[model samples]
Target chain A: MYKIKVHVYLKENILDPQGKAVTNALHQLGFNEVQTVRVGKYFQLFTDNVDDIESRIKSMCQKLLVNEVIEDVDFTIENAA
Target chain B: MYKIKVHVYLKENILDPQGKAVTNALHQLGFNEVQTVRVGKYFQLFTDNVDDIESRIKSMCQKLLVNEVIEDVDFTIENAA
Candidate 1:
């Protein structure tokens, strides 16, 4: 099997309310160090197919894993078993 | 400023319904290669404090950013203007 790690995040132009909320909370806690925060999704996929795995995962991302119009995804695959 | 990237995921023994659902959907879509899927959260924290940033972020993760009982968090810090 292969272990795939994927990171998905909003495009640079999009507004992320959850991130803003977290940032504000940090500031309220007197953590003046915080400048900004952005929240997103991470996914791990276990697969049996090993051949051309990167392309396969990319295809999966395109079809169901991400909204290409608003989010960008990056992934890495590792051999598990 | 510094950019802190965090990855938060469920503990090994925890059940991930969202991951399972995605796996089932992929199989139904004829992608039998997929064996399992796990979903998690990712965060990017922009901070102004660069000195001893790692410990500070780890403290944040332990306090409000994660449920220590159910999830594990890992983070990296980068220098960003």
Candidate 2:
């Protein structure tokens, strides 16, 4: 099987209110060194070996896993036992 | 500055309905090779250099970034321009 780890996050220009809130909370908690926080989604997928796994995974991301207009996605695929 | 990437996921034995839903959706989309899908949270934090950054980051995870009861967190810290 192949193990795919995907990370989807907001575009750099996009506002991330959740991340901002977390930053503020961290500051209030005495972690003043924290400058910024960006939140995103992570996914782990286990799939049977297939032809052109990279393209297939990318298609999956485009079709169902990510909103391309606002989010950017990157993934790493590795062999799994 | 230091860049920290944090990943938080539910405990192995915990039920992940959201992941299950995504798996079903993928199957519906004809991606039958997909065997399992696990979803988690990802966070990127930018922080000023500090003493014992590793320990401090761990503290942050324990105190605010993770529930620790049902979720597990792991992070990587690196220097950033």
Chain B TM-score against the true chain B, each candidate:
0.89, 0.92
C-alpha lDDT score of every prediction, in listed order = 0.87, 0.92
Q: lDDT for model 1, on a 0 to 1 scale?
A: 0.87
* Residue B70, candidate 1: C-alpha displacement in angstroms: 0.6
Model 1: which docking level applies?
medium
RMSD to the native, candidate 2? 1.1
Residue B50, model 1: Cα distance from true site in angstroms: 1.6
Clashing pairs in 1: A1-A81
> How many backbone overlaps does candidate 2 show?
0
lDDT of 2 by residue, A1-81 (tens): 888999999999999999999999999989888899999999999987767888988999999999999999999988887
Please state the Cα-based DockQ of model 2 relative to the true two-chain complex. Answer: 0.87
TM-score of 2: 0.95
Residue lDDT tens for model 1, B29-81:
77788888999999999877777777888888887789999999888888777
